[model samples]
Target: MGFPSLYGGLTCLDFANTVDGRALPEPEEHLHDYADLVRWAAYADLLDTETAHHLALLAKARPQAAAASYTAALRLREATFRLCAAPPAANDLALIQQGYAEAMSTATLTPAGTHYTWTLAGDHLDRAWWPAAVSAVELLTTDRLARVKVCASSGGCDGLFLDISKNGSRRWCDMGTCGVEAKISRQTARRRAARRTTP
Candidate 1:
């Protein structure tokens, strides 16, 4: 989906990568490729989607639920950057920014009491998704207030949080574990499977 949707996806994990805590290098400090952070952020969005659904339902009843909706979306963006900040190429950044903004543009705040409950009332859904545009500012900002993940220009490999150690000197998700296993598995699996199918 779009980045606004993608950003919401990251909130699922609440930005907690390690079950435990030690000195860890920041995600923005490494992982220069958008693929790394974007993928992880997208993974996080899967979790956020559920939370957003429940929250949206609650907002239907609760008067102050607008804040919750906004907060949840805000968190999604934060966590995505926390784990996978990368500097996208100019074209990629523009694409992501525009798409997310466009998606959010149709969002509307159904007046509740004091603060309006957000809803898709404009056009994001009519053609594709207009009603869900409440999440647009969640992707961008509201009343001029916005917070988003700024892609970095340099960093280490993907999932580096899992790679850093007790001393926190490591980079990459795992040089000894996932990094090597992936290579070995790819090399062995193809050869073995190819032989089994060979004449």
Candidate 2:
């Protein structure tokens, strides 16, 4: 339907979260089409409403370019997941480094409120994917990596989150979805175990 909630906290990580699981064969991808991708980008603050509308139209006019951009986004998304989900090996590290290099190449240092910020440049079809790429790089190169966590919910929700909690014990990608689901599941299991023990 509409863009999903920003459960992953950061735009880039949220982009990686367009899918649900890590198991092979078929993770639940939310970006079915270019429009979906653009909508998700807009939700992530990578595209303004006006720019998103223009990009959506551009995607319709130039399907091939749109498809290419979609593919690039997915590749970066996977690379980001690999970087965060576990201790990346040489290849995984290289993929992330390449993604970061690409993002940095297109970025320019600009003044924000009181500090400088990296802003993406270019009016290309793939520009929509840069912000998320930059965010992925930022997360990877910071101390925040210690806070990154995969969801603990069972049944393969497979969401990731930056646990910004004070104690860093925050679990579940979303209390409404995975959180509630896990609670219900634990309760059901306890009930079943009780029944088994009872005559």
Candidate 3:
């Protein structure tokens, strides 16, 4: 009933999925406002508890700034979506690179466990989208492109996901929803065909 996170595995690319079925009159838009964005950040592990609380307070205090952050987040998501959906043209790649550069400019590397991780300081609007942007850039530049997949459900689900299965056969964003529905649909079709062919 709440905002769906079925495709959160893809981080920023998942944000592109907030609004689905573009042709429908009422598309499923998860990021209705700044609060929704924070909810998504929590799901993505982009915001720690302290930063998230501060951001929520900031949103309440400066609604306009919050709106701008939401808009910027959407733009970065779109750029990531396009890059993942296909091989980007020169212009498309340039736009995504520009976004990645901007995000990296505000982030600092901090040692976490045994590896270094990007961390942003304070609760600026920039921080709202920084982690997600960094994640998108990481996925794009790494060797994971071969495993990036768009949902193959016939119900027109446009969820983007990473196919990390052994056989690389992962087709649905979540097996419980679109995958189950598609399986049921296939079984029903087979039964109908069998009945029609019976003597």
Candidate 4:
């Protein structure tokens, strides 16, 4: 019900993981509504508390607009997942391009200690997903894109993450959850095989 752990190591990838069990028949959806989207933006540090509150109130006031924004967010999230974890599709890339353009149109170049960063301005409903769009574009354009990976748990997690391991051997999204489950499953399989052979 609550947002999945931020194991993706990137805000955009985490946003993609807002759905659990992407490989399952029916994945679990965490962002059920516009308010949930705002809360997720806040959780992902994409929005300040005040800005999140403002957006939540704005969503309530403009329900139809908020619904449209939510639909766009979901579109961006799926496009990000495909672009990061599979062979890039032209349509997916186009969606990301449109999202990035829209996000950048409203972004301001703000000073951040030593350098400037593109900060989304205003409390528009799309504020919840603008940073995600920007982040997806940034990651896709960088060499770090090589580090993006999909979960390898045999239980079929299908979560996306940036594998920052020294040898790039990380296979699971979380060592404590998917990793453990896979390890246990393998051990059980081995034990069963051993039993069958012994008999």
Candidate 3 has an lDDT of 0.76
Top model number, lDDT: 4
Model 1: per-residue Cα lDDT over 1-199, one tens digit each: 2221121222322232311121336332211222223233334442134434444444445534444433433333333334334443444334335435654565466889888864432211121111222233243333211222221112222331321134634433434554566667678999999999999
Return whichever of 3 and 4 wins on lDDT.
Answer: 4
Q: Which candidate gets the maximum TM-score versus the true structure?
A: 4
CA deviation > 4 Å runs, candidate 4: 87-89
Runs in model 2 deviating more than 4 A are 86-90, 109-111, 114-116
Candidate 2 overall lDDT versus native? 0.79
Off by over 4 Å in 3: 6-8, 21-26, 86-92
TM-score of each candidate structure, all chains considered together:
0.27, 0.84, 0.86, 0.94
What is the lDDT for 87 in model 3?
Answer: 53
lDDT of each: 0.35, 0.79, 0.76, 0.90
Enumerate residue pairs that collide in model 4: none
Task: Flag the better candidate by TM-score, 1 or 4.
Answer: 4
Write one digit per residue (lDDT tens) for candidate 4, span 1-199: 4789999999899999999998898989999988899998888888898999899889889999999999999989989998887666679988988989988888889999999987887667898898889989899899989999999987778999999999999999999999999999999999999999995
lDDT of 4 at 131: 88
